[model samples]
Target chain A: MKTQKFLLTEQEMPRKWYNIMADMPTPMEPPLHPGTGQPCGPEDLAPIFPMNLIEQEVSTDRWIDIPEEILDRYAIWRPSPLFRARNLEKALDTPARIYFKNEGVSPAGSHKPNTALAQAYYNKVAGTKKITTETGAGQWGSSLAMCCAFFGIECKVFMVKISYNQKPYRRLMMETWGANCTASPSTETKAGRSILEKNPDSPGSLGMAISEAVEEAVSDENTKYALGSVLNHVMIHQSIIGLEAQKQMEMAGDYPDVIIGSAGGGSNFAGLAFPFARDKINGKEIDIIAVEPTSCPTMTRGPFAYDFGDTVQMTPLLPMHTLGHNFVPAPIHAGGLRYHGMSPIVSQLILDNIIRPEAIHQLETFKAGLTFARSEGYISAPECNHAVAMTIREALKAKEEGKEKVILFNWSGHGLVDMASYASYFKGELADHDLPQEQIDAALKDLETLPKPRQGGK
Target chain B: MSTFSTAPPSDDVQVRCPRLGHQVHFGYCRAENLGSPCFKALDCWYLQFDVVGYFKQTLSGADFAAAFVHQGRPKMQTLVDLIQQAKQGTPEEPSGPGKGSA
Candidate 1:
């Protein structure tokens, strides 16, 4: 298949990129080398993590406490607004009140900086020299690179091959941040070489990129791997978004009937829902829903089992909701949501039935995203559009039920980096790829290899 | 030392902690139904048990720091430790909640 690329004139460049990390609390855990298990020198992590993770624990009795110094340095486009979508409610002719926490204002244009700054900060403090990571849509990579530039850390990003080929401007953005960007499945590592040996022109998946990134970190003694999502610390760091939003909602004198977020490795969703989940656990009656692409329904369709988090299986087996380690999802425009497994914490919540999960098609999600962009003047990431679709559907149901409902969702990212996807959507050029049942079964079969529980409890 | 493939005819895989210089027999652990220990040295799991007890006991402050940092990498390990600590002696705590063999 011939790849389609978008060309943008200099004037077409986005006027601003918001850095929301400045206003958020830093994370507690610092960066350490995986192999050495030692605190990395600032120079050690300089290659991979160009920024540090600031630490802050969520407080039940008070609003989040963001340090002024960190905020001043990192908050280029922070204090993101929370909008009450009265017009959207009127369009639906429903009594449901819809509110959105807009994170599209940040540079790199997503909720990514919430952790990027924290990761960069920790790396800087640890004296690590650099950071290395993989990005699908380039938001996480660009966001990390931007944070690194701020901290004077070196950033290296292995972008997914297809996205790198299709989204040159995203690569350029990383370069603008002084990050060295390379397309995955390039001749950088043994893993990439092996994959390329099989299919020279294969459009790489996030799993493939993860393997490359891990390989880079494992091979290099100085560098540590920085994941954008899936880990607990990342979610913990991202909770500032939920913490702030919870405060902002209180300021608006409204409580959400339902909280929505799009899940890809589940960090953004957890970032928005964890605080509310705390409330729910403590007797708050609210619905928390996670929206994912049907193309990679790890929570909804996957088995809750112990599986290797990475394709190489170098990492320990984590018990989570997984579509198996080998499941390479069909390419969806919601590139961030195409991972094989959800975060362990998010998976546990879904397994325990604390949160509900729904999967949506790409076409419908993009349509909903377009509707939201036209209405609100901010284009959402394709992944974020899943929440938009779910919100619209719920609002319509509320109208039918004649019930006044309050809906709040995270506009986790902007689609400015996703103009190619929108162009495809407008030109009627996008199509959703559904994996064959045979392939899914093949992947599921690998789950049987996991170590099983003994016959009797000791 | 054998490495097991995800494919059929399952065998054993031996893994060594590069930092601790400890060798763990993954197959033996599976056969004996033992859970993987948390990487953090200060955690109860680390204090109470060892993956490879054959190592000479030399617990130092540096070792503790190393394990603590290693534990930070996998967020699940810390969470599992926290939850286990919270549920210790509580009726709600599952018997083997987060054990890999479970």
Candidate 2:
């Protein structure tokens, strides 16, 4: 009786990505220099990123035009379908209408390519021949690899070593796309070598891998670094997800009352929720939830302050919800969600109370994944399980309250290639690593040693 | 209830290893795939899954030896060569000098 799927034509795809910074309730705190404690400018970022992306990072413009070339390439997967999870709703038997923007349809099987394609295009235009990056679960690496293949640029990925050992096909996919992916703590770079020497069996955190990739990028003349998340430009490029969903929702004749997305470094969550967050900023009644893993509860447990984005303190200091730059979470199956820090923009939004963050356990998320797969016929990636789990929570809550609520979440990717994690789940081998309050307190104590941010971004 | 802090698997022979139908996650490492740390021979060349600590923890030394398959190119000094040098002792597990570390 109701529309089961909302589809958009390629021509209907948005030409401009939304910039939530323009409509934020308050201005963002400028990123600071670890050395000077002063605000960092373009020169501070030029060594690692192309000038085009740097511009977008600091951009206050409400909308930035997407280049036609990028749009042409995006047409291959752009205008991805929005599905009404009618089956999932029926399974839950709640009065909630569940919808998901299926980002798993992309070639890399994730929403990561939405920004990877844009980053590669900008770097190619800037005449950069090679890009170095870090991947947590290999989603970002594979997506960047595919984008680089289309642009004829070289891609080097430093994947977190645990993920390298856990998700091998994630490596195969990247290699097949013409990228070279190495495990972090390798002898390839100074940063990697030093970390390896310090603790050879170190499971290799995302922060450590980022330091290696950033070192590689800064050392080369023609090489630039690409990040999958936790940066402004990356999230800005990802806004296409929300923009398209807005159109699809209009077509479906319904608007979401609640928006949810899983937060890793926060781009996926910000991408789909920031547009609606704009409405919330303006007196609209909507609930925005950013779900995170209980194992690495940066959003729920960490403090908002200036911290290095990388473990080795090479990146400019961003005021974010950090679980200490050196702190590494246990090797959870959801590798992509293991970052110690979050995006500064998302951190600012959280500070302003524009969004709420909820932590979900690994076991609960896996259960939600299995439930959704059985009902919705799509196996969700482990990192994406957090959002799905939260969606189920809200749907059940609505049922308890006898209210019909519209629930929407970003289905960041599919878990078909990540079957090993699912296999572990089915076998009862996956352990839940809750962040002990003592560990959280120790990590916060580590942050107390760092230079405190100037109060008002002066 | 007090929480348990379990020792992480000595070598990353995670459950995914069997599911992927490979002994290790990145597959048998080749010279061309040195981009990965396991086969780097330069620093992380110790084939972790075949390390003595892991073998003693889960299975037998000879069993791990039999499962060890060499995949690197002929000219390249692979983990197979370095594992032989380590004497397969659990105490020497994490500190293997690898093969060609500078």
Candidate 3:
């Protein structure tokens, strides 16, 4: 009866991903090599990444064309539906029109495949035999595994230990797709061994997982490493989400007044909001929000600096919002949102004051997730609850202000696989974990121990 | 990946590789190590995977994005097997034990 779903045909999918690097207000600081303390060049990354992806990582081109092969694979699930949340609106009793891009329909059940397919396609073309990567909650690993299956490449996923146990389905999904999934801190890599030695009962962190994945990818000539979020290229591939939203919103005869998505490593939020962020940079009136959990408040409490991306100091120094890399996050149910850093692009945008980052507690996020699942009829992944909570917050604020507003967010994926989190929530086993300021300060203090960012290396 | 219980040099002991269950020296394979040892896989998935040696020496940062980082996918089969769908409970009601939120 009402205009509910805006659908796009395969042919209608955008051909090029929007790159925010070309439009950033401030030039980004180049990533530095760990050993040299100098800016890393393409050859330095040649070991772990194909040259094609390395180019995409550093490309400042406003629009980079998507390879036909990648687009063909994307046709399987591209042009995911954009829906106006009529039920959610009625439940909120607000005048705001809420819209969400459904990314759960992919084979991997998340926006991760948007890049996984792309990464797999490029590596396949590059004659790469396999990809090694890390996952916090298993979404990216399985997505990559499925992409590798389609492309006839091999995949290895190092899933964080806590999530490996919490979400059994995540590991099974990866294994079913033929990717090897393992628990971190298993004494497989030098990094993992060192960590296990120090704390035998360590619940592995994303930082440790990255170290393990990078070690394997770098040591093998035929394998390369792929990351799910927080990097320039991963976010670039995810632009398909936001680009599609732009066209879909026009079909609904509306544009978002405020845009939001949960930020773990920042890819999903970047995927659904960066295209709009481009419009905002060009003087469009829009509010872009990146939400994260209070348990691991990298953006809200972390500093904007050049920091290592992993714990064992095996990765390069990226300019991002970080609580120190050595800081281990509290084991929150939103396992995907449990990192110590934000994406470099996201950090730079916040520095330029273009994107607004918000932090929500675990219990409130669970409440928001439950609210949406009951009304909208789709369970959300725990990580996505952060955005849903913020969207509801914005909608209620609109009502209190007596103003009609358009609220948009990425319903990044469904939580059916993560029902364990909800089960824990219903059982009252999950609690809001707020990192005290003292811990945040101590973590930031650890950054002082690392080599500083290049003073003038623009 | 190997099952030969060779002792590791130094503190790095060879444990079962989480992916394939092979007895790999600590840190021998990243996916095997960085993965959740909080749980373990059944076998060593890639034991003789030897194209591994050809890749150039790993640069100090995995080239830079893989380290002192902060915290940070999905897929699946049908409705019944993966996980128990939230028992169809009302969101407002507290079913679990403990301090329920107001």
Report clashes for each candidate as comma-separated counts: 49, 0, 38
Better of 1 and 2 by TM-score: 2
DockQ of each: 0.02, 0.04, 0.04
Q: All candidates: CA RMSD in angstroms?
A: 15.5, 10.4, 14.0
Please, what are the lDDT tens digits per residue for candidate 2 over residues A10-95? 89999999999898776887865555657767876777778999899899999999999899999999898999999999999999
Reference-based TM-score of each model: 0.65, 0.77, 0.75
Residue-wise lDDT of candidate 1 within B1-102, one digit each (tens)? 112123322223332211111222333222211122223111211112242231124334443323222221233332233223222322111111111100
- Candidate 2: tens digits of C-alpha lDDT, residues B13-48: 442221112123332221112222321211111222
Give me the displacement of residue A10 in model 2, in angstroms: 0.7
User: For model 1, how does the per-residue alpha-carbon lDDT over A1-458 read when each residue is reduced to its tens digit?
Assistant: 32111222223222222122221222122323333434434444233333333222111222334444346654576566678877677666888888888877678788888778777777776776777777755777888899888889888888866567766777899999999998876788776776677667655544456556655655565675676766555776677667667777776677999999998767788878887877775678989999987655667777766555443443444455766655544434555564445665666666545678988877889888877877767788767899999999889889999988889999888777666556667776455556557867897897788753221112
Best by TM-score: 2
* Whole-model lDDT per candidate: 0.59, 0.71, 0.69
Report the Cα interface RMSD of each model, rounded to 1 decimal: 19.2, 16.0, 20.1
Regarding lDDT, does 1 or 3 come out ahead?
3
Give candidate 1 misplaced runs (Cα > 4 Å).
Answer: A1-69, A160-162, A183-222, A308-316, A323-331, A431-458, B1-102
Residue-wise lDDT of candidate 3 within A1-458, one digit each (tens)? 99889999999999999899998877887765555657667776677779999899899999999988888899998899999999999999999999999999998888989988998999998999989887755777889999999999999888867667766787899999999888875687766777787667766654456666766776668988776666689889999999999999999999999999998767899999899999998999899999987655677777676565445555455565766655544434565564445677787788677898898977899999989988999898777888999999999999999889999999999877766567767877555545546756777887887765433224
